[model samples]
Target: MRVLLDHNIPHELRRLFPKDHDVYTAQFLGWEDYEDGELLNAAMDNNFAVLVTMDTSLPYQRNIDSFSLGVVVLDVHPATPDVLTSRMDRLVEACSRAASAREVVTLN
Candidate 1:
């Protein structure tokens, strides 16, 4: 699936996704200034299927059910390359669930 790495997530984390999953960061897309909803819309417009973020509040703040683009919350505090690397399995699973279900998938 085409995935967008939200601004809050470390850009380096893009390396965590599988080879088949095409991924890019908000900064790379020139969307680092976008808000949650606007970012989602922009990602959707560009045909991105899932948005990976560390901002856990996005699911509560946005009504994501109506959009085809799904949001996957990392659910990690003080997000770091090492910390996120340890949770790679959960992140990958959540991302797949988000894409297939088209809903908010939170890692806890």
Candidate 2:
């Protein structure tokens, strides 16, 4: 799956994702300041299968069903690299199976 990590997530987490999948980040894409809707549109346009974000309100703020990309919203309390790393498997699984327009899987 091609996953796009949100700006809130640590860039290093990209390395923890499954080796077979293609993962990119908002920072890497030079879209760190783009609005959620625009970002989602860009992600879908690029054929990104999933979007990982730490923002809890993203699902509620945006009309996800309007798009065609899966989303994983990490809900951990302390979103450190170690904390996120522990749940990489779950995140990966969510990303792989997520095909809905809006899929928000919490990592807490």
Q: Which candidate is the best by TM-score?
A: 1
The sequence of per-residue lDDT tens digits that candidate 2 reaches over residues 4-103 is 9988989999998777889899999998999999899999999998898988999899988788888888899787788888888888887766654356
TM-score of each: 0.94, 0.93
Candidate 1 versus the native: TM-score? 0.94
Cα miss at 69, model 1 (Å)?
1.4
Off by over 4 Å in 1: none
**Which residue runs does candidate 2 get wrong by more than 4 Å?**
100-102
Error of 2 at 13 (Å): 0.4
Q: Which of the numbered candidates is closest to the native, going by highest lDDT?
A: 1
* Candidate 2, position 69, lDDT: 86
Across residues 2-105, which tens digit of lDDT does each residue of candidate 1 receive? 99999888888889888988999999999999988899999999999899988878888888987888789888865778988898888888888998889898
* CA lDDT of every candidate: 0.88, 0.85
Pairs in steric clash, model 1: none
